[model samples]
Target chain A: MKSSEWPLVIFSLAIQLSAGIMVIYDLFILFPMYRSRVAFPSKYHWILLIALGAALVGVIFSFLHLGNPTNAPRSLSNIGTSWLSREITGVLIYSALLMGTTILHFVMPSAGRSLKWLVDLTALTGVILIFIMSKIYMIPARPAWNSVFTPLGFYMAAIVMGASLLLLFQINHGSWASQKSLAILTISIPVIQLAILPIYMSWLGHPDFAGGKGLAILLHNHLIAFYLRLVLYLLAIAFGFWAFFTIRSDTTQNRLLFAPALLAWASILAAQIVDRLLFYTQNISPEGF
Target chain B: MSTFGFFCDTSACSGCKTCQVSCKDKNDLDAGIRFRRVYEVVGANWNKTDEGAWEHDIVAYNLSIGCNHCENPACVKACPTKAMHAELDGMILIDPNKCIGCRYCEWACPYGAPQYNKLKGIMQKCDFCRDYVLEGKPPACVSSCPMRVLEFGPISQLIEKHGDNRSVYPLPDPSITRPALFIRKHPGAKLAKKLNASIINREEVKE
Candidate 1:
């Protein structure tokens, strides 16, 4: 991949990770147990902060991807047609909602309950943002990226990274209500992502899809990066399993879960980065050799 | 709308690259940047005769291409800043002032027309020589072709003169962008079904 696209790799991964975490938190933790648990608000606060921080960093990386960062404000001008414009608008809206939610949680915790719609809004926007982000690469010109696999891969990265980070947070905070179920769920995400690898690779190799030259480029020039991405995915899955078992086995709660948790997070995040890099590198446009 | 387009006669092209040079010279493009490129599409196979003599069947042709100024320009559709746009004449243009230089248009274009200008830090491509066209003068590449193989004018006129046959070996399906390009095929032009045909000038035209 061109070194210039590193920023985009980081940008997509970070934002999708942020969105994934929000979706996981809302679906698993907030919606089900928030009313019964007093600590839910504080947990939500920290989670929102993490998501927002990631999204903000993603925005910064996106700016770095541009040759003229000063002109980025005009990026939303083509929302009528451009997926990039839609993506920018989606992320900005999500970030703004997240900021508002975080502010409400800190400034007036009591008002946060009434402003639950804001959190829901943020989560919805975040999900839509991820979809739009994927759509940006679904160009008809780039045969490598113009497929169902692109969006599927993007969502998988989001879910795996998000869930991994959330599990780490939960373990560190000693919140054990649904940790087992969450771990089981999170562990499955990477497995599912891994499962789709073969299909994506096969599609890329097909003569009707990426064509002969495209396959040659993948097998020769990007072979190392592609295998490394696969290895990273496996490593992430292995770490996830280890973390899940550790969480399950530790009845006394005295055992150190930090190592596995950190490893899982790092491995999954690294896998996502590698995957994003491959996505950019393997983009063989229809007219490109 | 008067849609501007390109017409290339692959049969007459000599692969001399005079168009490429003229374009670079006129635009002052950098070393790796080329607005106009001539791709050599080649196919070859050997056959054994009944008399035990080997016969070679080889086909080769040059495709001098620039921006097609597509009727459904994907670059314009993908440009987040609307920097890639279509004028009243339907010639796609890049406005450096509005461009963030994200290269989204570069990726979206099937013709590989949008080029990143590192010196200017923006996307650049043929604007159908807007300044020259406005003055009723041909584009540099069109005027400088030593083989007289390239032509440009309104899409309707080009089609009327040349018919609508834009597909060539190594080029993607023209229906994708509905490129306003027309072509007079080389007598030995390789068909899309010829899986053996390959673009030989890939490294030379890489941008």
Candidate 2:
């Protein structure tokens, strides 16, 4: 991949990671179990901070991708037809709602009913943000990314990375109530991602899908990166399962869980970075073929 | 709105690439960037005749291409900024001031028209030589061809003159973008069924 595209890879992953964490946090942590068990308001602050920090970093990286960052505001002018414009709009809406919800949670700690609505709105916007993000890559001219697998791969990355980060935070805070579920989720998401690999590869190799040039690049030049991406995902799954079983078997809530959790997150994030690089580099314009 | 368009006669072109060179010179394009390109398509294989003599069923022709300034330009639809916009004369031009250089239009265009100029940090393409056309002068490519294979005029007039035969090997179906450009295919041009003809100058044209 060209060095110029690194910022895009980082930007997309960071934002998706932030969105995924927000969705998982709202569904698993905030709404169902935590409201009843504990009244710890500080945890909400930390979760919001992590999500916002990642999102801000993503925004910064995106600016680096632009030739004239100051002119980026003009990108929203074509939202009627351009998916890129819609993606920018989606991210802005999601970020604004997320900020508002975070402020509401802090200002009115006892306003449970009101806060639930805001949180749900933020989570929904995040889901839509990811959808728009995937749509931006579904260009008909570039056959490598013009498939259902592009969106599926993007969502899977978001879920796996988000859940892994949340698990790390949970371990750090000594909250083990939902460790088993989170662990199972983290492990299973990558497996689901792995299940789609063969299908994606088959599609890439198919004559009707990418034409000969795209197939040649995938099978010849980028074959190693593709296989390495699969290996990293498998490693991440193994680490996730091992961390889960290890934490489950140990009744003491040992301090050693941190290492495995961090490892699992790193492997998953690395795999996603590699996947994005492949997506950008192996793009074969149908006209060129 | 009335639109200017190109008419190329592949039957007369000799693949000299003067059109491509003159376009680069006129635009002052940097190395590795060609606003216009001449593609050499070649298809041949040995065949045994009924008289038991080996014969070659060979086909060869040239296609000089730039932006077609399509009626339904995907680049315009895909551009996030209004940087890529159609003018009053139906010519698409990129405003560098508004452009963020996202390169999304590069991926959206099937003709590979929107080229990223890394030095300029913006997308660039043939604007159908808007200034020249406004002055009632032909585009650089149209004027530079020694064989007089290239012509430019109002799309309606060009259609009347050229009869709308745009399909050629390696070009996507014209219905996709409804490109304004028209072509007069060479007798030796490969048919749709024989589109497996290799592009002879792949390295030169690949951006």
Candidate 3:
């Protein structure tokens, strides 16, 4: 991949991770609290705030991907036809909602119950943001990225990162059942990614212009990186399962649960980073080669 | 609308690269940016004769290319800021003021027409030498071709005069963007593809 595209790698991953974090928070924490009055731990506002921080980081890096950051605001002008425009709009709306939600949690803690709808809206926007982001790479000329794998990889990477990160965060904060569930989610997403790998490779292995070239790139040129990505995913899956079994059915604030969860997060982060790098490499233009 | 287009007689192109140099000079492109590129398609294979002797059949040709200013340009549709748009004559161009320099159009164009200018921090491409076209002159590459291989005109006229062959070996399918390039294929292009010919000068033209 070109060095110039590195900013895009970080931008896509960070946004997906941020969206994943908000979605997980909405599903595991906010929904339960809204429905059953499971009052959040005192430091729970930090979660949404962290999500917003990640979103901000993503948005900032997105500008770094541009040739003229000053003109980025005009990038939204063509949402009528351009997926890039739609993606920019989605990022702006998602980031704004995330900021507003985080502000509400920080400024009006007592009013948290009344603002469930706002949090839900922010989470929904985040999901749509990831979808729009994936659509940016679904370019018809870029046959390597013009497939279901683009959206699937984005979603799975986001979910795994979110689940792993939440497992680390809630080690001593949340209930055992929820932490265990997060661990299971962490395990499943990567495992599902592993399952999708061969099918994606097989599709790429077909004897055609883009397919043969993409498979050759992965297997011949970037073989070490491809293997490293796979190994990281497998390592993440193993660490997730370890974290899952480590958590007991008690509220003893287990200190031992931290290592595997942290490892899982770290491994999955590396995997996703490598995955993004590899994704850009797959931009095998039909004419350039 | 009068759509600008390119007519490349690949049969006459001798890999001289004068057209490519002319475009680079006219646009003042840097080392990594090529508004017009020449691809050398080369391949050969050996065959066994009835006399039990091996004979090789070789094919080689050049494709000197620039922006086609397509009727359905992927770059135009892909540009988020509307910087890459078509004029009334369908000559696609980039407006620097509105360009975010995201380079999405560069990726969307199958012909690799849109090139990133590191100095300008924006996407740049062949404008069909719109200024020259307006002044009743041909594009730089077209005028500069020593062999008279490159030509440009209204796309329909080019197609009708050139028999509508828009792509040859290794070029993308023209149907993808309905590119305005009409080509007179080199006689060896079919043999080149059968032998799995590829662009041999990729390093020289990389963007």
Candidate 4:
């Protein structure tokens, strides 16, 4: 189980990032555009395509996690009862909706306002996808994962990642007012995450479930990784604030903001990656699974 | 419906490896893959008497487990493919052809009953020795137990005879899966929990 767990770490993070980006791209980009406050170049929607590409990468590696993937289509058979099945189904529907939206953006460039509904649909599915994905891990068998922190960690990562990536994307675009909102979002989720760290750790220290052992494993075996993720979060926060202050209404200063924005994105991407790896290490099943 | 299951007399199990060995041999399982496992749970507390002599409170027991064919089979519910499913009699079995070998069922099963067949890329576990059952014989683990401490039959009969005690020490809460296993606890089982006993052979038995 340990040996095979790494692929899932990659698979979950990639899929979640893709879902988050699709979602943020909608709220941060689409809604404003729909309100006539800003006009994004048709090329801007391709960020959704980039998100789709990450999802494709996630799907590819997810197969690596399977012992036999030829039967993957059958993975959807138990959707009536299985979260795993629903998750797989969600991925398919999300990717398809995103793909349809992206393709329409290119094929029917004049259909912009008409296609807003489609893009909105894609984004809604992404949210559902993340929820279903989180639900898959909340089963009772692994109490370490069956907690509030699991979904919290997941949603926060998506928001942080999406905001940073979108902040970087929107730095040179969007109305100055919307840019402020994006910058604030980029800076705040990580702050909230930082605040949650000690509390999450304390939750793990309890004897209920295998949390005590999970905490022990975290402090003993993965202490360095834990510290590394913390440092990354701090760096992410610093960079996020740096990027936020760098954002100015003046279009010329947008060029100056790119450095801090890109740095913030990089820092956050690294933190979330390390955070996800640490999440898997907590699989400390009850005494003996 | 048969609702086939196992009954273990924990008080009589001598921590012998025979049931574990026989199951492996009968299944032709590769190393590290086990259909039945014996868990040696041991715990201890030490105190000094006024006479300066050391006194000990030690608890030890063996728990033999296979899949309980849980009525609320989490594996079946967690399985992406319908690979792991329950039959009409409430016995859980994996349909290898449908299994994607995702190993999700492994995480869902509390008893660690499902074993990943790395070579086959599929999950495998005790089917209550279906061939032998049909032939009116006990599963290999039960027949080979030197203490005659293991039994297999319809779970209803076993629960009636064993007095319906499945939430024994060291085993997880049976309510999670409602596993069909029935047990007769060893006297020390309660003390094992109080002393925080742990399985000593984790490496050998872990998937």
In order, what are the TM-scores of chain A for the candidates?
Answer: 0.92, 0.91, 0.96, 0.95
User: Candidate 2 on B109-154: residue-level lDDT in tens?
Assistant: 9887888887777889998887887798999999989999999998
Reference-based lDDT, residue A203, model 3: 89
lDDT tens string, model 2, A62-127? Answer: 889877777899999999999999988888888888888788777877677777777778888888
- Better model by lDDT, 2 or 4? 4
**Considering every candidate listed, which one attains the maximal lDDT?**
3
Query: What is the descending DockQ order?
Result: 4, 1, 3, 2
Instruction: Please give the CA lDDT of all the candidate structures.
Output: 0.81, 0.82, 0.86, 0.84
* Pairs that collide, model 4: none
Which lDDT tens digits does candidate 4 get at residues B1-207? 237889999999998979989999999999999989998888999989999999999998888998888888899889988889888878789999999998889888888999999899999999998888889999999999999999998877897888788768878888888888889899998788778888988887784
What is the model-wide C-alpha lDDT for candidate 3? 0.86
Worst 10 contiguous positions by lDDT, candidate 1 chain B: B190-199
Candidate 4 per-residue lDDT over residues A218-279, each given as its tens digit: 88998998899888888887887887777787845698888888888898889988898888
- Model 3: clashing residue pairs? none
Assign candidate 3 its CAPRI class. Answer: medium
Candidate 1: lDDT of B56? 82
Candidate 1: true interface contacts recovered: 0.81
Model 3 C-alpha lDDT per residue in residues B1-207, reported as the tens digit of each score: 337788999899988999888888998888988889999988899999999999998989999888888778888888899999988777888999999889899889988888888778899988888889899999999999999999888877886788888898888887888888888988988897678788888888884
The clash numbers for all candidates, in the given order, read 0, 0, 0, 0
